[model samples]
Target: MDLISSRLLFRPMEERDRRFMRRFLSDGELTRWLPVDYPCPMEQVHLHVDRRLEHWDKHGFGTFVLEEREGEGPVGYCGLEHVTETPFIDLRYGLVQSAQGRGLAFEAAMRVVTYGFHGLQLPRIFGAAMPDNKASVAVLTKVGMRPDKRFDCYGSNLFTASVDRVAFDLKAQPVTHTGIYGAHG
Candidate 1:
């Protein structure tokens, strides 16, 4: 259950993360790539974080605040959770602008993807990002997920990417909707 790398550490999201989340989620430039509306109010940020905490209880896994090291402020958050009825565990992450472009997002996400498969014994993990959000696409791709489809999500068109461990092991292919429940065929 240890999801740690040289540059990142993952811990359950905490109330103190509100300020960092507010700053990151509210950044106009960064939010443009995200499905969230820009200028996200602090209230909405609070609500989102609270929901993530609840998700941890119900789903056994949810968003986690990413730390730079053992004793540093949170730089971002990432997690794997099966939202609502979604058959696949969804991977999500965001980093403050200062933290971007340093490969931290990919590192954090890959760690969670590994935890989802090896720790939780999940069959698959998926993530969605705006088609133009190259950074996010790169992160997913770098972690061995391939684009599975283009679809509408939260009023925006996004490219969905996923990877199945068995498929990757057998065919070495990253494109698949097969999840813990079943495949998307």
Candidate 2:
């Protein structure tokens, strides 16, 4: 397991997770706000899983598969990615349609953020989402990430959220409700 949450588990991506990735990566609605420039193909999803595994081995932290604890079904993914020009971890997450509105994204993200700050000792974490992704915005805010600014990305306004290392509220515990978790920033 990569990490554990109250009602979910963050684990290394495996070959078995490819099917889940296919379902998630192909969802145009979910991908609309993602930072990737092109459509995510299944082949690429498999490659991404492999890369995530390698990343874990090398960096001790990487994107993880999020699964519910009851039946251990995959619900989404969340993790920190290194931004090229900044000394910050880019917090990212995605979930299936069934998982939307359930707050699983928030729970999964809190675990990722906690690991990035408390476990990995990262100094800062940030996120970017399309301005229209209110759900994401709400989750980011709930977790204590403040809106840093708005920037252009692929011709769209991307809202930036960040938490300073020294100011991160690492003590905030996740609230699990109906398999959904809540956190700010």
For candidate 1, write residues 1-185 as lDDT tens digits.
33566567788886777788888777787677876566688788888778887888887788988888755788888998775654667889988777899888977876677667766888888888887888898888877788776323444468787888764345323424322222331
Which pairs clash in model 2?
142-183, 142-184, 142-185, 143-183, 143-184, 143-185, 144-184, 144-185, 145-185
lDDT of 2 by residue, 1-185 (tens): 45676667788776787788777887777687786643577678677667766766777677888877775588888888765444557887988777788878887877777777767778778888777889998888877788775323223467787886565554354444312122222
Report lDDT (CA) for all predictions.
0.74, 0.72
The candidate maximizing TM-score is: 1
Off by over 4 Å in 1: 150-156, 167-185
Q: What is the alpha-carbon lDDT for the whole of candidate 1?
A: 0.74
Q: Largest lDDT belongs to which candidate?
A: 1
How displaced is residue 124 in candidate 2, in Å? Answer: 0.5
